[model samples]
Target chain A: MRYLLIYDITHDGTRSKVADVCLDYGLNRIQYSAFLGELSPAHQRELLLKVHQRLGKHGANIQLFPLDEKAWVGRKSIEREERQNNE
Target chain B: MRYLLIYDITHDGTRSKVADVCLDYGLNRIQYSAFLGELSPAHQRELLLKVHQRLGKHGANIQLFPLDEKAWVGRKSIEREERQNNE
Candidate 1:
């Protein structure tokens, strides 16, 4: 399933760090504060757990939105285009 | 482009009426108060105008979100599935 995770960082200087971890885990950064990702159910659970662990109690707020398939198409296209450009 | 429109009805008994109008205009109802639609630029503008006209001053609030191609994929799949199942 594809999910849109919207989060705000609680600690200082954690935006880049959190974003790096998310990218490493295959989450596509959409807006500065939001990410879009597709994961198996197992992966989704793992990712969320890892995020919580990484952020600990300082992870501001998180909203996980399970998007329908249509939402994923646009995000995937953008990711594909970005990959093709190597940027 | 695909867009998500989230709005709340201001007056009473307008939910069903508004939803009916949205369905007529090919917008997919996601949550009770949210809709996902793929619309041409022109159509989007027209739809927004029409929605405002229909709701007048009683439309609680409206937020229009433009989704990337990936996001549209999920919605379209659900829509397709719905279309396939008539019974």
Candidate 2:
């Protein structure tokens, strides 16, 4: 299952730690605070638990969103051309 | 159906125009390059065409991903605490 992970943490130390954890799980960084990857339900739960441990009592919030195959087709992205159009 | 829109454009003018179009469709900005909202299939297709029109021959890419109800509940987010934790 494809998943989107978005997070907001108070501590810089913990925030980067979360990023590393997500990368360790093979999730791609879509944005500074967002990541995307394919993981099993069990894997997803495991990552959540690990993130929770890092969060500790800092009161940070982290969210995981599942994106099914149908949703995958619905994704859109735009890449700009290298050359500029004067017109 | 919930949808996520992600885009990259060469021109600032076209980029902001796209953002306005997304807002007109009632989508929320989840990030600088991403927007989220619920749209019907027809509406989804309609928005796609409008976005395409805006692109013209500039070679910008825009993608729309459909997110179902099952996927919505799978969303996760974190909010930081207001107070400092000395401990």
Candidate 3:
């Protein structure tokens, strides 16, 4: 499954630190502030725990949305259209 | 690319009504309240416009996230894990 992790850092310094931690954990930064990654439920749980441990109370607000294949295709089509428009 | 549209209705009736319009617009309901759909930029724009026009001031809050193929694959992997665990 694919997961979109959208998070807003509380401060600029925190964003950089969070990004570093995410990179270390095998997650890729998709947008400026969002992450795109693949992980099993167990891995997801581990990832969240790591996030909390590393950032502690200073961690940013986060929302994770899990997508199935069909939804993924639909989102991809929209992205293609957006890219085409931008080009 | 994949897109996830997450929305929260103001009331129960609004939820049912929004679901109906989403069904009419070639979108499938993924969660009880969320929609999964493939749409081009033009279509996305049109969809939003229609949603606004139909629901007017009563429309629910909506957020759309566009994803790339890689992200979609990742998300799908997570969903598979979740489903497997459920089964």
Candidate structures ordered by DockQ, highest first: 2, 3, 1
TM-score of chain A of each: 0.69, 0.84, 0.74
TM-score of 3: 0.47
- On a 0 to 100 scale, what is the lDDT of residue A69 in model 3? 68
Candidate whose lDDT is highest: 2
lDDT tens readout by residue for model 3, B1-87: 345665556556655766776777778776554566677787777776666555544535555666556545454211111122234
Chain A of candidate 3 compared with the true chain A, TM-score: 0.74
lDDT tens string, model 1, A1-87? 767665556466654666776687788976555666777777777776666556643435554556665544433211111122233
lDDT of 2 by residue, A15-68 (tens): 888999999899998766678899988888889888877776676766677888
Worst 10 residues of 3 chain B by lDDT: B76-85
In DockQ, how does model 2 score against the reference complex? Answer: 0.47
lDDT of 1 at B28: 94
Q: Look at candidate 3 and tell me the lDDT of residue A15.
A: 58
Local distance difference test, each candidate: 0.58, 0.76, 0.59
List, residue by residue over B2-65, the lDDT tens digit for candidate 2: 7877666757888888888898888998766668898887887778777877766665656666
Q: If you superpose only chain B onto the true chain B, what TM-score does each candidate give? A: 0.68, 0.79, 0.72
True contacts kept of each: 0.05, 0.68, 0.03
lDDT, candidate 1, at B2: 69
Candidate 2 docking band: acceptable
